[model samples]
Target: MGWFSKDIQTMDDLFVHQLQDIYYAEQQILKALPGMIDKATDPQLKQAFEDHRKQTETHITRLQAVFRMHGAAVKGQDCPAIDGIIEEAEEVAGEVEDKRVLDAALIAAAQAVEHYEMTRYGTLVAWARQLGRPDCAAELEKTLKEEQAADEKLTDIAVSAVNRKAA
Candidate 1:
């Protein structure tokens, strides 16, 4: 179900909806990252992708924990945003022929994923607070901070070196 659907009419609803969204997104990321790792020409970029793949796995586990804490079942609904993002990444990766350019594209794509996670986590954190679940929010916040830091690192890779190398 979509976030604005009849099922979600409160902060708790939005929070859980986003939790499932990120959970699904992380699973998709786990499936997608190996290809990205293979496509990356730069060793650091490849390693970064690998590291985030592991981190995303942890994110899924954390989401599951939060669901349990909230007395909700661990499950996921379709997340159009993540699906679109990943599809666009695949398209862009396929379109680029040069290795350096592809690495840059991969970084860009990775950052897109990070940004999506940031928004979800940020909102979820607030929702958790609204629901009077600071413990849940704190756990979610840790992952949020990590995702943001990863985004910044990916931006550095793209701006400081990868995009320039590609160009």
Candidate 2:
């Protein structure tokens, strides 16, 4: 179903729709990370993308488990938000001429994606609790923590080196 076309007659429906949305977003991130890893000039930044790619694999598994818990099929809807974020990242990365500047741009792009994920996972956790599925909430909480950590790590990398190098 299209974004607005989902029949969200109840909170449960909304919750499931959001779950699918994030699921799709994660898949897109998985596809994008390899390219980011390839484009990264700094060794640390490259490693971070690689590590997060692995973490994303675990996230997909967790999402699948959540689907099972919700009695929903393991699938995803189109997530244009993630697509646009990733596309912007690619475009900016291509435009950057200096390696250091490209690294900085990459960090910024990654943080944008992480911020989006943080919001989605945060909402999912709250909705799962409201839906009386503490189990699902607990699972989503794990992913939320990971996203927060990833964002913080990106910030640390940016402040410590990438941004200064770009300057």
lDDT values, one for every candidate? 0.89, 0.95
**Mind giving the per-residue lDDT tens digits that candidate 2 earns over 1-167?**
45465587889888888999999999999999999999999888999999999999999999999999999988898998999999999999999999999999999999999999999999999999999999999999999999999999999999999999999
Model 2, residue 16: C-alpha shift (Å):
0.5
- The sequence of per-residue lDDT tens digits that candidate 1 reaches over residues 1-167 is 54377888777777787888888888988899999999999888988898898888888899999999998889987888999999999999999999999999899899999899898899889889989999899999999999998898888888888988999
> How far off is residue 129 in model 1, in Å?
0.9
List pairs with backbone clashes in candidate 2.
Answer: none
Stretch of 10 with least lDDT, candidate 1: 1-10
Which candidate leads in lDDT?
2
Task: List TM-score per model, in order.
Answer: 0.95, 0.97
Which pairs of residues clash in candidate 1, taking residues 3 or more apart in a chain or in different chains? Answer: none
